[model samples]
Target: MIKACALLLLAFNCCAAEIEGLSAIGVGGIPMARQEAIQDALMQASLWNGAKVEASSSVENGRVSELQRVFPVQILDRYKLLREWREGSFYHVMIETDPKPDPVPAEKIAASAPAEVLATPVAAAAQGVLAKPVPVRECAQSDFAYRKKLLLAHFQLQNPADANDLSHFQDGLQQELSRMLSASDHYLPQRTVNEAAFNLQPGFYDPVLQPERVRELARRYGTQFVVGGVIRDIGAYGEQYGLAWGSDIRSGERKISASIPMLKLNGWMPAVAELGLKIKPSSRRFEADVYVFDGASGALLKQQRFADSATGDVIQGRDYIFGSRRFYETDFGKMVEQQLEQMVAGVDQALACQAFAARISRVDKDRIFIDAGSTARITKGDKLQLFRVSGSNQLVPAVNGDSSMSLGTPEALLSAVTITQVQPLFAIAILESGSIRPEVGDYVRFSMKESR
Candidate 1:
């Protein structure tokens, strides 16, 4: 990551007042790049001092010939080019400025009072007071994690033979888990039929996995994470017995009994007793290992095993009261729902531990546009922090699976902003403080909390 420093550079010899500035430039087309760097530097300096400066430039062959900036508040005491270098596509230069030896007269300060930016010519404004670019930095642990679009794939069954219908069990678990997750305040779950592989090489699991393929699926769904799981064990269990009822024909009385029938009891009776089937303490068990992966990097973020069981009673081969036995309404469904509840809570908590941010797409005067909108749980009147990019670099692999890493450190805070208008996929905001102007590709974020 690149680090840009902004501090008090130099003090005047004769005057008590001090002024300072630091600026860096990257490579583009030679003339254009230099021009941009110089302009940005001046604007950054102006932001620090909160004063507008005037510029005069001479052009040569449609390029910059000579450029001079005049600070109406004070004169420059001294200046120096601190450092210059080339990295990747950017040519960086850091410059520092000092204040003049003598203070300006009071009447001069009054005469050069700043005017409205719109009243100036476009050329002058462009070359005039640009707010200092805030430095971009690594997000702290307290950073916000936005609710993201997510996809839950069908869980693979560890013991397929244990499930009478593998597809049904997988679908059942997936749907229930999705329901629970969608109900939470942590994520916006997206339903998808995409199947992601579990293991790369042949292992105890089925369907060979390719990490790249999983990432592609996530991209297609515009989701930040993909959830998958394995059904480790599942089964339905119960015992059945017979109950008997007898009637005394003469007395018109009836007797009912249940017993472990043996050969020694009252021998037998015809048309006096009837036997019916009954189930005792029937139960269904569900156990699964759930895994969550980063959609951008295909790395596992969380994993856990969750299990639960539900029990019920049956009489005459039917529910004790409902008089029917259906898959969805039975103990199996109840047990599955319980398992999903646990899984959902686990996933919601895990994802909330991550930081979330939206990128700036455009900037017009005091208003800025962000890439996140209603889908991301952003609303009108929400306040967000703005960061300026100072420097960034790709992280090299120092250990296994670190090749995809990148780092950016923000140096200064621009200002807070509030959402003024919201669309389905984007939002527009205006700065609460105009001391710093936001730029495209800057980051905006807010702290996340559970609403429910």
Candidate 2:
């Protein structure tokens, strides 16, 4: 049997072996049992693929000594733990291994090989069969490395109760949303806003005026997008247990008394008391209205209502307790995490597809300044294209013959400019080519492959 196994082992190399066996082991108490199980599974896979062990022996007089030698093969990089559990006293694990593809063999051309073998179709197919595979791009990591800056506002509470609790909850909601976006490879950390920049009265929050106000605020922050919204409702609500009784205290002997008469009789009395109470687990519900704004245009790009609920199951003694502190352990936290994930995903898709543009604030000699800054992911050494309005109807003689107006295509005015400095709200760049000079209000957009 050993010789047969050795023959099989010699048939395949360590790097190109496929796993085909089962392994089970008794696992004792360990802090890292799951990790240990994975390791054991890997070991079994290695041996099943094509690993071997050998022993050498030497004899002198009547004494003999033996030494063991083990030849180990490399294991698969990708594998799945199929199942893991404890049967009676031993923990058993099963694994499925994924092996790499076999190497292609070189084709040999004979002197009398048919001309059809060298035909385009046959030749191409043969070359493809032997060609190295093209590497697949990892979009998640690449998307993350793309630089984009954003700003998030503290979401307002709509119809909020005049209490401090609601305020804290609102703050937490905004923080969690921001945290989700920060975690992605999509956008950078939110830019901090200087509150004193926007001083306003009541109507500034009104629907008719909010967009313009938000636009102004975005300009000050120098960001591409501003996230703002109101939380509609967020709190833990109670669910009735529905006519159920739980024993608060078990029945036991409370008191006993005994008396003995001189003749022969004795009597004893006993008393007991038990208490019962009603209890129920409370459920938490979180609802919020989320919105995203294009900072440059002050236009509402996206609005969504995110909601989640969970059973507040943390128990304290005989009663169940529910609060924000304990919410993380409940299902509500998972729901919130998932919702935030979707929000970040949406932002990434929109930013990647949207057309981005910025306006020149001013120009000084060869240096130019634009109203977009680091908040919009403007990085130093980045290149941007320049364009100018041309052939507008305003150029027509207004007096008699032609008074109508028509917008014209933007003419290429200048070559790409290299960004030199980036501030919170704007960036400075120097033009590298083209005769047309940049002026205030000229439109600028990122050069291809420059912005994420």
Candidate 3:
């Protein structure tokens, strides 16, 4: 069997093309033959199912110009480039390999297999032999991991003052901060929550003393960062309400005075309130600004602010305060969760946008060529949009006999062409629309309407 296999391989090699300066296995180096094969393989990949290729050449510029003229036919794994060499007297070729396709998700394979096979450990153990183990390493403590202490100091208004109400409000704030931290993926360890302290002041606004208070707490708690803010009265108004005892009883009218308290706080409170208001039945208004600073230098790294309102009802014995004055339990808690989620989403979007920007690069074409073959990441049937970045005067041509005669202006549109082949740098697209034939050096962009 071995002798037969060897003989068959020998026969195959003998029949293979013997192009000069080309490698057959792609190991010796990329030559015309191997490059052609790689380009063909790229076209075969599902990424370019329907694509076309065009050809053109330039004389004045060097190899770089020719390369620019050549379009990317397919996307290969960056690691696939193995060898490169000169082809004939004028052409330089590069050979590459296809990237390994992503493995089937474990869930998919398990779902397809027999239930008994999936349930038993035998199959899993057998598969383990073929799979790579994830590496585990111990984590080291760093400056980024160091935890800081946060203190929120604010003044509470005592109109029919209740110490228990203030306590409940403080508890609500702490709970909200905890939820926000838990929801975030980047939260650091060693976060110490200091007990919220409320002071009695006559005025609606109290000086925000949390910064200094945080420093004091940090010394006592051995923490790195501090957070604080205040609560003040923004405005107040009166609402009229009617209470009826029975159908025969005339409704008794009464006016209730409502006061708006401004809670100027640091860190997560205001943010949670802002997000919570998006939910229905919340009416607690708050504005919070949070900042992270260096432990020693107090240099700020991250800062953000959020504002929102909460409204609903508060029960007072037999009577209920229903108009916009709600106790901080129900609405406040819900708001905190919503705010945390929004903050996390905002951070994720910003990071993703940055990453996306880094991956896309721009290239200009000097000549026109049909993108062809399976290796070029082109498909057998794909359409592309072509555009030219020419000046308005160049775009509009003068009448042949009358230079003064105005012709219609040119506009950008999608190419009416099917892709036949895809190459490394370029693709071959057949014109499907317009009477004018696209020439070399015409700028083209592609959109995948039917991606594989």
TM-score, one value per model: 0.46, 0.45, 0.28
Q: Rank the candidates by TM-score, best first.
A: 1, 2, 3
Clashing pairs in 2: 144-185
On lDDT, who's better, 2 or 3? 2
> Alpha-carbon error at 159 in model 2, in Å?
3.9
Residue-wise lDDT of candidate 3 within 372-402, one digit each (tens)? 2333234556544455434334424345733
**Every model's Cα RMSD, please?**
21.2, 25.8, 25.6
Query: Where's the lowest-lDDT run of ten residues in candidate 2?
Result: 1-10
Q: How close is candidate 3 to the true structure, as a TM-score?
A: 0.28
Show where candidate 3 strays beyond 4 Å: 1-167, 188-216, 219-224, 232-284, 300-304, 314-452
Question: How far in Å is the alpha carbon of 219 misplaced in model 1?
Answer: 1.8
Residue 339's lDDT in candidate 3: 55
Residue 8 CA displacement from its true place in model 2, Å: 52
